[model samples]
Target: MKRRRHQKTRGDMMKKTLLAATFAVWIFNVHAQGSMTIYGSIDSGVTHISNVAGTKLTRVDSGNRQPDRIGIRGSEDLGGGVKTVFQLENGYVTDTGAQLNPAKLFNRGAYVGIGNNFGTLTFGRQNNFMFDMVGKYSNGFLLGSFYAFHPGNIDDLTNAGAYDNAVKLVSAPISGVTLGAMYALGEQSGDSARNRAFSLGANYAAGPFKIAAALSDSNNRSLTLGQTTGIRTLLGRTLISGSAQAPVYSALATDKVRSVAVSGSYAMGPALLHALHVQTDISVAAATATMKSSELGVNYRITPANSLNLGVAHTSLNDMSWDQLTLNNVYSLSKRTAVYAQALHQRASGTGTVAAVNSFGYATGQRQSAIRIGVHHLF
Candidate 1:
């Protein structure tokens, strides 16, 4: 935990140091120059998990249907089809009114850049293409809640996937196709590539169908794994107290890590179909770990105000395997508010592995389940 905290702290500090100049324009008030907007969402709930090292527990949860966050973003017209753009977003804990990440005030994103009709180029702390492309086309989107994310979120579909000190380019849709690329600097003094990362993605949308694909590679601990993926999963970590924790899914720290994924969604009348596949590989020093995950799901809008989601996923990490099932129901109170209930179950097999569902932590048994009831609001 301490090591992970320090890693985020270093990333936040470096991003701030590297992008201070770019953000000056934003500080001077871009709103007066053009258009600005404030936006936010809050999702809080009560959840029950069947196992946490053998004891069942119920508690309050935040960011279930959506992340709890508030942000300000704006663009200043530079004329001739060009513009200056910037955004600052932060996440908070609904239960305690605390920042999601204590390392920085804008843990979600802090970036400034230029945009044209064709595309946009941005710099600073941001998310990778993997999160952008895969998320838009994956079953995870229809599920509309973190509870339905695959076990361990090994594929990163449900992870924050944030990168600091990053430069990113995203193209506007052209003939239904959008392209994206990103790179994050490690900024290490002696060695240049110690913690560098890069990612590429493409997305296509046409009427009722959409598809996306992404590729990513990183060195050391450059990329922030999803909250569920953890930092090191292979042998686990040694705590500051000198105690050891058993490995959860198998994300061993390595010199190099690579990931590839593709996902698609189709809308048919009031029903939606979703499918996705993800592959992750680690090599060079330490031990090699490979993880593969896939999912298929469907979402149906039974009524304008009611919807249902069902999904099943499978994951294989080296010698460990996990299978999960989830069901969710939601009722829209209005365009910006909704109430939901979800249930998830996971079955684990292989090499001392125990089942663990999304955001419920670890389990001591081979079977684990969770149920949650929540409300989501946006403004």
Candidate 2:
């Protein structure tokens, strides 16, 4: 009897051990189902500009092709064809290692939302819908491969084109077409419309052709009295920290801004062609001003690792007009790394427009030129 009892006890212990092991494995599998990922890119280059403030300048610059940034993205499956998602991104300067926007930690993007079979609804600081659609047709996504933009990126299609306290939505592509919209709260104490912002955009892609259209508006953009010398001075500083592009009008206290743009691109074999047009208006307490701009560009892929980009843009506001041309050659050392050389030339005519190339400020004469050699890497 004692021997039989011992055998039965041992067997029971083994069964319990196996059961515990199976339970642990099941727990591990359940935990592994959710995923989070961290991703980003870094870029830097050497640049030389002729006639910035009447002097030649050479320095190290960040993001000649694309802005240097780091971001974290996470997603959790909630079952029933729905998921929860979040993203946080930060922008920095490679040369100085300074935050792109000093006021906010995740200045580039920060959003949380849910996604279902229908679409996505997100809330937080985010890029406008117009910017999202225009990226498809703007050369290399925007600003003519980052060499130059339309006289201060007047259409607000370039970097840092985000809105605060906003809600945005993106619909899944249905038959190669998608739509996006966004509304931002100005958050002024008493007046809801004081600094409100909103945008709408649509995009379509089929075969080798793509096109997009967008419209955006902002009201009562805040401006620092000390930093903004005049309407043009403040407008030129739109990309800098504490400044925004909402389509301001006059040199006096500006109130409202609006913009409309359409862009398209066609890819043919090794060559790609792109075109864009934008019209922006600003309203101030004193008067209203309108600016219109157009751009045409082409990209040729010589090899899987080598490419050439060229672009030309023209912008006009009242009596002021400006023109810019850019050419860049990019050679990829690997899938995530590249070395490039670029040249840019710009001219300003008409009465009020000064020769300004991006953030370089006013050129000495009506014409200015620049050259850059740079490297970029993705992670």
TM-score of each: 0.85, 0.84
Q: State, as a TM-score between 0 and 1, how close model 2 is to the true structure.
A: 0.84
Index of the highest-TM-score prediction: 1
Give the runs in model 1 whose Cα sits over 4 Å from its true position: 1-32, 222-252, 284-286
The 0-to-1 C-alpha lDDT of every candidate, in the order given, reads 0.81, 0.77
CA error at residue 52 for candidate 2, angstroms: 0.6
Which predicted model would earn the best lDDT?
A: 1
Compute the lDDT for candidate 2.
0.77
The whole-model C-alpha lDDT of candidate 1 against the native structure comes to 0.81
